[model samples]
Target: MMTTALSPEHSGDETPKVKDYSPTSYITHSNFEFCGYSLKIARTLSASLGVSAYVWEAGIALCRYFEKEKISFAGKKVIELGSGTGIVGILAALLGGNVTITDKPTILEQIKNNVSTNIPPACRHRLKVRPLTWGQDHTNFPTDYDFILGSDIVYSLVSQPSLIETLRHLSNQGATIYLSSEFRTGNGSLPFHEVLLPDYFNCQVVDRLMGKDITVYKMTKISTDPADGL
Candidate 1:
């Protein structure tokens, strides 16, 4: 799978290129094959919408890892955060997970469209789209998920703390979390890995796509009480 980026600043049919990445302005849709099903994702481009309308490399990489490892989401209760195009969460549903796909309220419609396009009528009941703005709307969800998924969500340092907080809130002791991120200089990803996340969860790098500079992490919550150590 090829990686794509969005340059939301430019407009009017002229595609602005970002380094080795292609801007999503000219690309209205993307296609992918996962779990033996072909997925056609519709994309919208606007200076205001930014990254939420496009599928990032990290999201695709995570989907590839799932198929490669034959990861089982069968019968699992799953939720995906920052579900931009809803690709990752949609795949989880296809793998038999009862899934909730979420992003900011503005992006929820796009995700809902993708879910409807890809998931068949029979499996439609297995997935739902909801609005989730990290730390703010986490209470609306229950802490009983079997797995939590995210991709390319840790772009801003300002949002990392809240994202970590939401992750902690949504996961129970038995829940597992999976996050995939692209490596970029000066991005919040480093601090998230080194500082914020370690305080709340035990994380391990379960997969790496070295060529793409993306890594997928598996995390489980750490006990909050000091007494647990004793």
Candidate 2:
């Protein structure tokens, strides 16, 4: 079945866990040179199947968009839905956006642990974490956000509908959603989103060469509202 949101049960338990670590001792990617900063990929994705520990491509573009476009995340409310490893969401809060870094409760602890480790202390004052699953409806949210971000979130066809629906529901009027993805030749899951996105959004792809094995695409949400516009 096609879905666009996830139930809070996806977050697992409410056990609050937070720990700190040093990247110097961790086995992570050596360098991700983009957006004027070097992001580390850390590990090949162990969270789910087929997904590798590849660093976020379009995410790097979104970071560049923040810096080059002089995008102000400072004091703005932000959410990173389906944030895997949450590099971009952490970046948003670090840069001054009042950020909510959410994922399945399953990964929520990992998100917090990563936040403690990754956020450069200089900007750590502005970020927080939450449990959010797309496609599963809920009434909990800040009610409005100046920006909502997702990066490389598509991995299944069912997720596309949930993602689109979640984006529509969570977005405020005139709010902007910055999503990024790369075209995969025949992953069965790659092109799934391309067709579905146009239904609820005027999607645009921003392309650029990132590395030897990556091409990034950014999808901007042009217009939408809750209730699926359905």
Candidate 3:
């Protein structure tokens, strides 16, 4: 729809470290196959107000949702946590279900455009894009969601705890939380996620391959968290 776009593969993040709000471009791939129907969706960044967002690798990740349709999504109110490109969780919504997308304040607008571009005109009403900073007040988040998701978000020591905290705060009484991440060494390269999450939610590891060495961990959160015994 828009001419602005990013690369399918990031050679390097040229995004400047600016504190002001503006539009930026994000690019990700979305490949969908239905019987003989194959479609590739490309997402571009659209910034307005102060939010910056883009659609990500929805086509590839959508395969995961198809594989794990039972747990990934189905008749659920879904919220995507730390949506870098917002592709992974947005596809879940496009498939059918209520979807809310969240990201840092800096990326708010990008999340909006990505979500908007992917949905049909009618289904556009079903999606919600909001600003969500980890460990911060989530004023508009519903009390419960059938599923919560995060993708490629745990890349720093500064963000892990806040992400988990946001996960816990938004998760409802028996909700399942799914976090997809690639392992990268950062200051948070300690026993961080291993220890903190168990305190509030039971974590289930769903392993998946991300290209090669990069692993996308499909972490599930249980309602009955038994941390004392662990």
Q: Is candidate 1 or candidate 2 better by lDDT?
A: 1
* Runs with alpha carbons beyond 4 Å of true place in candidate 1: 1-27, 225-230
Name the TM-score of candidate 1.
Answer: 0.86
Q: 190, model 1: CA deviation in Å?
A: 1.5
CA deviation > 4 Å runs, candidate 3: 1-72, 187-190, 210-230
Q: TM-scores of all models? A: 0.86, 0.68, 0.68
Put down candidate 1 lDDT per residue, 22-61, tens digits, no spaces. 4534335555677686787766665546888677778877
Q: Residues 122-221, candidate 2, lDDT per residue (tens digit)?
A: 7666787778777775357755878888766765666777777777777766566777655555543355555666666666655443452223344445
Better of 1 and 3 by TM-score: 1
- lDDT of candidates 1 onward, in order: 0.82, 0.59, 0.56
Query: Model 3, 1-230: lDDT tens per residue?
Result: 11122333421133323334345643544444422223334434344422223333332443354444444354678887767556655677766768888776776655565565666789877788787777776655776788777655565777777766677678766676665544546635234545766677666555554453223343445646467348
**Ranking of models by lDDT:** 1, 2, 3
Backbone clash numbers for all candidates listed: 0, 18, 8
* Residue 19 displacement (Å), model 2: 15
Best by lDDT: 1
> What lDDT, from 0 to 1, does candidate 1 have?
0.82
